[model samples]
Target chain A: MVSKPPPDATRRSEKSRRAIYAAALSLVGEVGYPRTTVEGIAARAGVGKQTIYRWWPSKADVLLEAFLDLSRQAAQEAGQEPYAIPDTGDLAADLKAVLRLTVDQLLDPRFEAPSRALAAEGLVNEPLGREFVTKLLEPQLQLYVDRLRAAQEAGEVRAGVDCRIALELFVSPLAQRWLQHTGPISYDYTDTLVEYALHGIASQPPRSA
Target chain B: MVSKPPPDATRRSEKSRRAIYAAALSLVGEVGYPRTTVEGIAARAGVGKQTIYRWWPSKADVLLEAFLDLSRQAAQEAGQEPYAIPDTGDLAADLKAVLRLTVDQLLDPRFEAPSRALAAEGLVNEPLGREFVTKLLEPQLQLYVDRLRAAQEAGEVRAGVDCRIALELFVSPLAQRWLQHTGPISYDYTDTLVEYALHGIASQPPRSA
Candidate 1:
């Protein structure tokens, strides 16, 4: 997650926020959600508990925002927009490019361990699960939805297609594969998903015989 | 969950095992996986903890086997064999039938909370995730692989298709929807997934221009 202020924010606050973000992610990964506490994050960040409580309401909120900050920072470092997937006009190419970046993120040790911890915790924690889904995951998914809607308008996708559900044809495979270790992630795999998704799966043409 | 066989011989012991299965399932749902214990299950089932331990190793194992048993019983109750997705030779109908059953299971209160707990644990615990996937999940997934391979032989699916990835097109979407609350799940959704998967998303037909 990124600091909310503009790039010109005080170096000290930026450093402290970064420290808190790192502390929040690392501690949760190490001890898990149950044992992870606000005090622990503050201690590890070299700040008072008030610093965290002042910023976020709960441990879940802190960690959620921390992940968002991490993602934004990671995207910026990659020279990509923090939120949007590349359009590139060609849907398949754009999808492949975005999924490749996703592969890198999923395989990154810094991102991997902490993400897995939170995701696992979300499986059982309903409120946290919904919060993470709403604040963090769904917004990212909506980006794909936007791109697909663009494709549909461009006539690359059939007019009758449900952009929301259609996006999942490819998107959810990557998600499940990563979340469940159901399979390996690769450019070839993602590229195939994008290709398979844009066209109909039946031997016939799209939307008709 | 099924009734366990008596240690050596006894009609009444079989009844106790069934009671234990029902108790374990109900307890895990009501109290959740973490709060559920051997003692709680024993007291609820009106059996000694030793009776449970004599049959299963750990609480996780108990819940896991209990789920497996429940699935079998549910399938049998539906008048079908457990683990076999009917190959009535209409691939789409078979998949839809199985997925509908999955929807029913995912929605079942007896299955919901405990399954969520196990799934949440699986996200972080690779060993447990792999164990359950191998024992409880992969076998189910393989049925789709087999069906796809059969479709390939019959010219229902493209000969070039990878059954593993092909199945994910339909399977992962339904899973992502269920696990993450990404979208609404319905027979319509599953039917659409099967159609999308068997064909693909390209603008052109798979066979030729």
Candidate 2:
């Protein structure tokens, strides 16, 4: 359906949209997703329920958008595009820079509780788990895949390596530590991970003569 | 108050114990931790509620014992010594063999449902999560730490590396994949992880020379 919008109307819609996203994030973080209601989001947002309904089908949809918005803002704050990983022909540096930023985000109090709440819910709730991975997590992972692929082209990685799985060597440890509280995380640790992942930890290169 | 046991009572206690463990795992798997009750476990286990109280003091203790029992049986079937990582000196082969077995365990239908239920609960429930990590998980992970320590002593790994964190290179990826369903796991995938972990992925060897 094609709809026409005047400039003033569009600006008003954007303002309401920001309010809804903020309200949704705060409510979910405070009350959690299962208990969060559209009425609560509308009231906290200082908007009518119809306004939220016009933009989002449910609280789930609203929260998802709220999370996506948070992620984009985080990416911008990190001085990188939300969906791109820089490939300067130095894979280690790029990966380290990105992972360091991730460590910061994971440690940030603003991001911690809400994301954990959402992720916890996602575990018991399969559809939401898949949705978060597909929309939020997988896309960030794809940026790594793309950078690795470019590295493959540059002869910086083994020719036959699968970039998708390759990225996990460094990525998954941080993920498990954060999710399970298995260990501490730091930029130095992540940098070492990138070094170990890119080179080989066997004390000798696998492809060496 | 100290209680004394009767002669044939030992057999009765054993039978009730097995039933209790079974009931706890199945009930938690079906209904999750927050909903699984002491009364429900007792009823399902076909024992007097006081029988459970006579042994463990709480529902959490019941579930923890249930998981420990499950892990013990699985380890025995895998020909693994419970709570030990076999130190065959060849770290790569040892880790790969253990992880391949783990791949089987993670995919086992009997283990999958209950593990997921517990893990999902762990994500939101701090006390249960910490208890599982301390009693169940850390002990297993420490076996790897011991093996890694042995490797370091043998001059196979760098001196400064932390055995605990180093094990995560091979371990956590598989875990994240299993817990989050991020990717399919296989023998080759785990083998690759062990290789990447030991030598590292950096294109150059250590400058420590």
Candidate 3:
């Protein structure tokens, strides 16, 4: 087994890591993905370039981890668990609750600029886009899939529905509005999405209802 | 009333306009929005820079109109009316058919590159993003709104449903999948989205059902 580092070394390392993450986020937000450099992050963080390379592979990796850390901090600050969607036996309520938090995260000044910048680069940079989606986005989407699957087993959702696609009915609308500036986003809007997704917009209710 | 241009002059102008549009789309696709210049577009189109300025006040206007023209041409090629979503009275079928055509358009090689480029720029450029949403994206979304409104009048959609948000239940899923590379887009996928939006994913059907 590897030995634990000395306490002083551990504290120092944690400080440097947080600084690097902050620097990475800010640098990427300011200059965008293409122009953001490892050297720039290191300089901003007051850390050596070797320290960054020792911990992360590249600028993309650095930014990805930075975003991940930022999200965790945001979730913690809001008293939310980062990984699980609460299965409170009311799917619509749970979804709306989470999405409202997402709206908060999306609108946070700390998250907005860096996310927009990275997302812009990701559009044209296919490899980076795929990497971020696979590592970051898909995992988050899987949480919804899991929630929907639980709802399905509980008979809260149609058994025939694909949970993955079902989740998108509410999720993607918020995403599009935020990313494309297609409309205003709020608790009211997201609450409406959840209600619509659960009950649909059809005049005739399902036979089960 | 304004005098008509000489027939030859009209023909010449049309040719120049087509060349300019082609140049603008390809250049933006290659170099992205910030790097693309009116000067470069005119040079590539074999027209004087003044020729472009005579028609469009800015590069953004030229690109916007170019995209509009491209969409009209694509719809025509597909034998679709450019502005209308068919109201066949079977709302689901009509929606599925239109979404299938949209899937084809999204996957079209000609539309993909330039659209991705412009969308990437729009993510970070608020004014440009708002302009495109107002002039291009919103009009297309309004077609769905109109169709949903008709359905409401026909007793096909619930009267209380917000048609704008209702359309996003289907439309935004497709948009997010395409924009983010989060999922594969296909006719089947779009058809499923339409079904889900119309009927919802909930277990109990509404009282009407």
Task: Report, for all candidates in order, the number of backbone clashes.
Answer: 17, 14, 6
Q: Judging by DockQ, tell me the better candidate of 2 and 3.
A: 3
Ranking by TM-score: 3, 2, 1
Q: Encode model 1's per-residue lDDT on B1-209: one tens digit a residue.
A: 98966666667777878888888888876665667899999999999999999988987787778878988988887788888878877777888888888777778777777677777777887887878888787888998888778877876666576778878888899888878777788988888787767655444454332
Residue A36 CA error for candidate 2 (Å)? 2.6
- Give DockQ per model, in order: 0.59, 0.55, 0.84
Model 3: share of true interface contacts reproduced = 0.92
Candidate 3's C-alpha runs over 4 A off are A206-209, B206-209
Q: Who wins the DockQ comparison?
A: 3
Ranked by lDDT, top first: 3, 2, 1
lDDT (0 to 1) per candidate? 0.81, 0.82, 0.93
Candidate 2 structure quality by residue, lDDT tens digits, A1-209: 97879989999999999999888888877877787899999999999999999888988888888888988899998887887887777888899999999999999877877787787777767788888888888888998999988887886776667778778889999988888777789998898778767754454456442
lDDT for model 3: 0.93
| TM-score list, all predictions | 0.91, 0.93, 0.98
Docking class for candidate 2? medium
Candidate 2 runs further than 4 Å off: A1-4, A207-209, B1-7, B206-209
True contacts kept of 1: 0.63
What's the C-alpha lDDT at position B208 in model 1?
37
